[model samples]
Target: MLNLETLSMDQYSFVANAFSFGLAVMASTTIFLWLMRSSVAPAYRMAVTITGLVTAIAAYHYLQIMLSWEHAVSIETGEVVATGEPFNRAYRYVDWLLTVPLLLIELILVMKLSQQETINKSLKLGGAAALMIVLGYPGEVAETIGTRMIFWILSMIPFLYIVYQLVIGLKESVDKQPENVKGLMHIAAYLVVASWAFYPLVYLLPLAGVTGGSAIVAVETGYTIADIVAKAVFGLFIFTIAVRKSEAEAGASGTSASKKA
Candidate 1:
């Protein structure tokens, strides 16, 4: 069982509200992304489809988290109290492990790079994303600041690689993107870097003296906020890139259908 503390009515409500909101947003985004897939060209459909898949995975995990969270605690006569059940924070890591790599893959597949370049970068970036999540989970579950810091340092190795891939390694790919979507591609890259930075910061909240219930609230809330942007908002960018790329290519599909439907 995870260490869950007694929260203020406000703290308990805040965390509960965050999870509830996350579930709704993720579920809605999944439906929207999937339904719009037919509006994009066939070549780009996979990219848009994968974007939906990311949110779909996220929605299911949020459901799991919300269920666990609701079962973990309650208010007893206006006093927040634990009900002998602890929230399974591992759901967050499990969610990340599956969805994070797919996030990278969607971005890559939408770019329409050469088949070889696509395979190489997708393997590299996707693998790095997976490694980062797996490495960070150890630090996340660690009790001591020392153990957490050690794992944090280790995890940053892959994170730095992801940043490098985004800022430097993928610069050419972003630049080669069609003029209509170039600006958006840069923003998407930066959003990934910025939004993903939230996780590590929240992971170290305890080290920064934000401990106990405050730390719990901060970590859970920060993670949900970050996931919304990283998955849902970023998925929009993926769809846009796919549509723009489709419109740019010969025999492109769904341009009129997209506008009409």
Candidate 2:
């Protein structure tokens, strides 16, 4: 069902390998954190579990992507031939399609929001995120820079909406978070902004006249870096937020019970 062609690694091989390794680490660490930390508040546990699933899915996809990159170029008698029919440049978008919404959902779950609020925000934000990824794909496969930019700009419409929901729409809710984890929530939100913002900058490089191997390097390496930060590092912050919030809630419960006695 997927490409299994084996060819020489290109300049992007090392970066691809690194990204694969990062995904592996993200998957293992988040799953381990979820399994071993079962005593946390139920909502927080669910959040961590979702984070694990997100990373695990990304890791699987990245492995395929890495292999695809390996076969995209071949060295033949001192000549390099491009041969990535199954290269699957869309793997990243596929990964984003699945994981981006989950990322937002994990943050929402960690906040322990009301049922109606949770469903509403999750649907709106997650739907917007999925649309953003779906819209970006056509641009990615576009044959010309002009068409690509048009699609890219169209994709940004949803992206900007997601950002607005994260920053302004959720401001009051984040403010109501436990004192200990309130700033952590903002940090998590800002990390999402910072990391996700890097993607478009990388995506636009080729349109800006960055051609040849340098463009490949910039696209691959820059995206890999952003992926690490957005998924791996951002997942860590989510874990921290969950743990801290769970502990704070547990302590508050104990205090309330003691007061009742």
Candidate 3:
């Protein structure tokens, strides 16, 4: 029912270009932020490291995705050419599997949670995150809409749990955060919800009988947009929060030391 020929060169071009842009931005962000090691306090160094690592992983996958897209379709006419290889949509999933848990870990680290609490929260949230990705992949590659829908529903369970953990489970920790960064922390949590919500919407398009070149273009492009927001932009907010927290702690330490003197 889906004709590859119906996909125009412009569609292919758009996806290709989007991937290229994502790769460039993510890679550049990784390099730029990693170089700022001297700027942030040691307390927050790992947070910045995780942020750069997230984008670095994304950049690598985006390059793979871009190349895969080009190989899957003939750029001249937007037709599927026999390249003796499958288009590597799995690159995104692989990227998510590795980066999603790190995203949660980075948030936890930046919050400066107690050792016990941090480990507990990280295991619960990270496990859920990994499960969500693993569950979604089956549906992503499912041949039938019914199969995809089942897996999607299964994945949403973990997804909803993640939202619950962030909003409710982490509330006390969030409340304990410095006033300056509290708002940004809330924004960071919401951004995860906002950006991740797009994926399911895009995934459901095929179920509505919107398959073929248009669906492919929509899914790929929509995903690329979401990835930019969720990873690159999300990392920026984390960096800001880390810096704010680090600075506040340094100022408090200096005041305490002066009092002692």
Candidate 4:
């Protein structure tokens, strides 16, 4: 009973191509990091691996969307686009579930590498944040009217946690009087906030469908773009910070060892 005529093939293709390209870029970056693993710290190496895995999962999610579009189009012509239901929605929810915790863990690892005095606090907060995200997953499996409400509430937890960490990091960077660190922290905070800002718009778009409008297509495309920006681009920025912190730590350690000798 879905209308394919409401969706534009050209638009769908463009979004699909963009997502595929972004995934390819992420995959390449992951392989490159693996090749240069020696230059990265052990903690950061784990972060890279986690990031790569999440990226791969995200890539698969986009591919599903693309396939779903094809299926929808085929169904319009009385043909089967593919088998089963579109798993794109499920993939996206699961992607967020995995990404949220991985990001917090990466941030904690970076703080430790930077030798921050409050590393213990950061670790505790990160653990709590991860737990909140984990709790959100049950909503993904929920069935009925209560499911969406639970999902929305649970999803908000990560947003709040990121905001808290962003404020803390920014304040700490300012107190330390380090221009480079402050600049990086400011950018990271902005990206985290920006990612959260897109969620509400994506959530509301579905309401347009009640009017028999083509909001479904718009919502799908909007989310695809948001994920690319938040998960792919913002994620790369986070990884860069981790890499820088690791290099700084390694350099300092070498210098200290030489001085002791």
Would you list the C-alpha lDDT of every candidate in the order shown?
A: 0.87, 0.80, 0.85, 0.58
Model 3 is weakest, by summed lDDT over 10 consecutive residues, at 75-84
Model 3 agreement with the true structure over 176-218: per-residue lDDT tens digits: 9999999999999989889988987877888888876788788
Report the Cα RMSD per candidate. 2.6, 3.9, 2.8, 4.8
lDDT for model 4 comes to 0.58
lDDT of 1 by residue, 122-164 (tens): 9999999999999999888887899999999999999999999
User: Which ranges of candidate 3 are over 4 A from the true structure?
Assistant: 1-4, 76-84, 255-261
Q: Write the per-residue lDDT of candidate 4 for residues 1-261, one digit (tens) a residue.
A: 333444455554555566566567556655654565555567667766665665666766666656655554443354324334443455566666666556555544544446564465456555655665566556545554366466657767765766766677446643453344546756766775687578654653333333222455466656666776666676576577666766566666986435434
Residue 235 alpha-carbon offset, candidate 3, angstroms: 0.2
Which candidate, 3 or 4, would have the higher lDDT against the true structure? 3
**Count: clashes, candidate 3:** 0
The parts of candidate 2 lying over 4 Å away from their true place are: 1-10, 76-79, 84-86, 255-261
Task: Work out the TM-score per prediction.
Answer: 0.93, 0.89, 0.93, 0.70
- Model 3 per-residue lDDT at 130: 98
lDDT of 2 by residue, 118-215 (tens): 99999999999999999998888888889899989999999999899899999999999988888889999999999999988877977787666656
* Stretches of candidate 4 exceeding 4 Å from the true structure: 1-5, 75-87, 113-154, 173-179, 208-214, 250-261
Clashes of 4: 0
Ranking by TM-score: 1, 3, 2, 4
Q: In model 1, what is the error at residue 26, expressed in angstroms?
A: 0.9
* Best candidate according to lDDT: 1
